[model samples]
Target: MVLNKIEQLLEKYENAETTLQEEQELKTYFSQDQIAPHLEVYRPLFAYYKASKHETFTKDIPLKTKNTNVYKWLTVAAVGVLMLGFYFNTSKHITTTDDDLGTIQDPELAYNEVVNTLELISKTLNKGTATVGYLQTYNQGIATVNYIHELEHTSNIIFKNNK
Candidate 1:
């Protein structure tokens, strides 16, 4: 009768309808030495299942150390310092005077001087304008000119109102 129950449980196990308790019972029955000769073929399968229940196939994976590129960061800092130094030097040179403050006294001359001074400032501040392609070069120059014109118009409006 126990052999018949074992055979039924094995059938349930094969059909994947056996509960965990039923599976454990099947394993228990097959693990004994008194199993029927006909069911002896299933002993190894049950042993594998029983062994797998307590056998852990999991492993603790060691984490890899992340490497940082400190030299790249150093290079970026060096470039930033160089850019700041260049900016300060160029700004000083562009604004420096030769003790002739009244030389640009005429408004028209002042306006042209302003435009030339702005162009020099833009050249110093915006070094990327030199490398722009022919297609974008006109647009970039136009944008700068428009910005300067807007500033000049605003200043003229303020000066006329004050006068």
Candidate 2:
């Protein structure tokens, strides 16, 4: 009778239909010293469930301290110092050749050069050829329209012949 009850409970557990009380009852019923031989296989399963409820972390060791913000501040300071050094080094060197001095001395001429480059790029993109697939589809559409016109013309010729 006890084994029958355990079997019913196990069926319900497998189907996820067992209540908390039914599960506790199953754990208690299986923990007895004398159990049916046929149900012995399920003994360890229930014992494991009961044992796991009391499982806890050991209290003998302390957790390590966290100082993540300090490391982040150090990284920021290192990057800032590097950027300052780079800026100072670059500022000391002049970037003008003899030709650049004559050309770049006027802001209006530099602006015109930039505008001309952009216009050239735009013109190149506008005059490009369509792809092979586009050309094929265009020719197919024209052929379809011509075929429809020929069919209409043939119908008109037959009507005139009948008259």
Write down the RMSD of all candidates, one decimal each. 22.4, 12.2
Which pairs in model 2 have colliding backbones?
A: none
- Per-candidate Cα lDDT values, in order, are 0.87, 0.86
How do the residues 7-94 of candidate 2 rate in per-residue lDDT, one tens digit apiece? 9998998899999999998888889988888878889999999899899988777577786999999999999999999988887655
- Look at candidate 1 and give me any clashing residue pairs: none
User: In model 1, which range of ten residues has the least summed lDDT?
Assistant: 126-135
**Cα RMSD of predicted structure 1:** 22.4
Q: Mind giving the per-residue lDDT tens digits that candidate 1 earns over 55-156?
A: 775888769855557877999999999999999999987897868556766789889998999999998877775555575878989999999999999999
Model 2 CA lDDT for position 34: 86
CA shift at 88, candidate 1, in angstroms? 38
| Count of steric clashes across candidates, in order | 0, 0
